[model samples]
Target: MTDLVLGPLLRHVGEHTAAIWVETADPAEVTVTAGEHQASARTFRVHGHHYALITLDGLEKGTKTPYQVESDGELVWPLEPSIYPDSVIATFDHEKPLRMAFGSCRTSVSHDSAGNKLHGVDSLRAYALRMSGVTDTDHEGDPDPGPGMRWPDFVLFLGDQVYADETSTEMQTFIEARRDVREPPWAELKDYAEYAQLYKVAWSDPVNRWLLSTVPSAMIFDDHDIRDDWNTSLAWKQEMEATTWWHGRIVSGLASYWVYQHLGNLAPEEREQDDIWQRINSHDGADEFDATDLLDEFADRADQEPESYRWSFTHDLGSQARLVVIDSRAARVLDTENRSMLDDSEMAWLDEQLRGDVDHLLIGTSLPFLLTPGLHYVEAFTEALAEGAWGQRWTDIGERMRQGIDLEHWAAFQDGFHKVSDMVLEVARGERGRAPETVTFLSGDVHHSYVSEARSPRKAARRRPRQQSRIIQAVCSPIRNQLPTGERIGARLAAYWIAGPIGRLMVKSAKVPTAPLRWKLLRGPWFDNNLATLEVLPHGLRMWWASGKVEDGVHHRPRLITVADVTIDKPTKETR
Candidate 1:
């Protein structure tokens, strides 16, 4: 009997269609049944694993329908005697408001006290417990959706879905058990099999598993998804290329990412356009068609020639809300002489997407575009110093300092920053089509949570930028990963009132030009394992942060608790 290996992850949910992703133990026909609608697909083999993405169509819009999975004619989903509710396919209504949950930088670890001690708590798991409402381990009562409880229409994982460099204790043991730790790449993942195992470890936790099986999700990659400082610069890339193991590591990273994450990020039509899916979908008379070589070659070319394929994508939600998720890590122009966070082609694509006419424009980037003014200036200064502003001697010092603290953010690539900022300003000032209620940047990577509101500069730095809609940058990071106490001090200090002027002066000394959009940290730089959700309201927007609190003895099940909240109303006056 064929069995499910990993998931039935809900993805690319539309008004009338949805995609279900799964990995089976063997090559088989996987079917997803939602009410009278049923869809099945033959499993495709990649790196010896059998996977299928079943696209279910012809469903009623804005309705909730319970779904089930069967592999090789055997019922598999809704695990026997399960305490959780039946997994449902929820299609959103286009006329309703949009709500979404988002965060990044989660490291898979145990839910025991030890894991909680090392890493605070898994916010995602807590959310599942809340949504699932399973009091005991045994099957008894049915799930209670709770009174007036609002579930997110979708969830976005900004980046660092996996930590390639910082392997957990469990991950290290898995690697050490198979091969000697003394080998090149050491405990780090070296190939596709290792990457597969790592992803299984990350997702197989029963609590988070149920959450994934139900809620539809979208994802992108950041530095740790491949390595610590991937694509920081051409020099860094050259250094890694000289290593014997980097080629294999990178190829496996991209390949696994394509199967495990990127495949589901695409819509039905978009998936058909993918060369990989084209091959997977066109399988005929196959003893499970293998795509190992094909995927590896694609991965290799993607890294070498980023312009050949695009990773960034956009999703339209509700009647006039749009979500644009950017790929900040991989699609970079790393040359120091003309460094940018995105290449020309990627920038052009983004240019086409960042227009107006939307009620709300949500920009999702792994790195926060608007860092607190103090920290934003700090990154800008370091970048300029590293680019020979203080001579070759200081450049060496600057480069070391930048990488040691990981100073590669939007500010580090000012050209790309200016380009995006111009688009944002234009959208905000009604230059696009009609002005949006808000032009917001949602991000997670900094290992802290904060809210910053942007305003046009009183003295025009270069070009005058007027604002009609409120512009905000909200950051919620480290869903599981926790920062060291010492590092937290540096993060908190950067947001101090005095640090802003000091950082600005340093940027000026380094010849950093004045910024068109000036922002102030409105809420926090709180260091906690937090997950945040945002809701588009009639007048404006409302966002709140939540964390997991494992009370006294019930360490296994952490209860969900509120953290902080932010409410943004319309901007009435030109305070700038």
Candidate 2:
């Protein structure tokens, strides 16, 4: 019903200021004003999404500035005059340190008292309330007494910002109310209107809306954002294409992907080259930019085969570090004969980006670089079995796994797995980039959280007597959703005793050898609603996970789930 649904939210900041990306249902005038300066953008079309990139340059580094948004001369939403609104306008204060809140997986539910109780005032929502000093007596938290808490430098949303597959009761209600659930474009999101409404439900919550309006956010998508088990493998692709509802589903998913998640993730320079979304942003009338045709083609290709495009991008933060945000789902190569995690072009781009001179080299992907030890070992074993590790006899078992008839992950794709793993290790040794202080892989999508260090035999042999190792793996997932009770116990036990030994023995006994890929939990598999923050400090790299806990029957307390003390010096070795 509103012209815009989600965002004028901020993302991808540099030394000066940050970028703000938004969506408008109707082609309208958009402008962002900070202090006395302003920039305006106009939407050229209606049947698709449009992006307005507002960069507040010449901003005082590390200072918060108040901002406002006007559409066709009327304010879309009220901005708090007391505190600033719009994109985060702060530079990285290395000495002051970075406080980034990272989380994923939220459902589109009401913001009523009952919903707040069930959802427990989402971490992002709580951050917003703290910033604005807004409180709901029904929802409990210590109300900040002072002017209010300062906003985080950035909020890293790993994935499932919206769940296209698992719709909540509210989302389903919208879908059913607007169209026939059994019909085309009705069974699921099939057009821009539906996508826009879906976004409204996902982001229009007052608390989250206020949070996004003020704080800068960076996001990546997982399976649920578009469809269930998106790009799991080749066979999964074939099955989805066979369905009557798939075409429109793909169209709406990718079309919305460009609008909601991908366009905003880009830095200023990258946004310039994106022609499709760029075209949408240039529209002046509703009829001018009808992208139903173009988006349809894009959707068809996205599902029929996923490797033809790239939705990934990278950012370099001066000399401090580089963040490589990869599109793990859409850019997959699913052919059994020639499987690859990234298509040739994307891989090449990634290789080029890998070259740098930064303190930390961070790779952000929705899928964790490491899987649960037991499941990971099993997947690795399955890959070996399919590759004829146990002669041709175990091929049936391999086939079943390949069909994604079972668990699928990096280990399942032997060729891609080895390639990415080798590349990551190479970067860790200072082979690429300024031999970063640490090569950290930041990921989500596993529905559990843990930190693992990658120990390579080659690196071990060449280990500097004085230089500390910098290869580390960190994962934080299911920011709002937790794993089922039944599976948690098994997963925890496997992380300790079962996964490593079983995997190693299978590899040795079958003569399908692999270097030691070991993992140990630095944080958790605890099923508590959680979020994590990673900071680079003078002492070393500090990482911690935070969750809201019902300490007493009266209120929820923000608690630290785990803390990892890492150093640039020699860390004690850990193995599977």
**Top-lDDT candidate index:** 1
Write down the RMSD of all candidates, one decimal each. 3.0, 4.3
The C-alpha stretches of model 2 lying farther than 4 A from their native spots are 1-4, 46-51, 79-88, 91-96, 111-121, 135-150, 182-191, 281-288, 302-308, 386-406, 458-468, 494-497, 508-512, 550-576
TM-score to true structure, per model? 0.96, 0.85
Cα error of candidate 2 at position 459, Å: 8.3
lDDT minimum window of 10 residues, candidate 2: 136-145
Candidate 1 — which residues are off by over 4 angstroms?
A: 135-148, 461-465, 495-499, 574-576
Sequence-dependent TM-score of model 2: 0.85
lDDT of 1: 0.86
Alpha-carbon deviation at 156 in model 2, angstroms: 1.9
Q: Would you give me the overall lDDT of model 2?
A: 0.64
Cα lDDT of model 1 by residue, 18-84, tens digit: 9999988888988899999999999888789888999999889888899999998899997888877
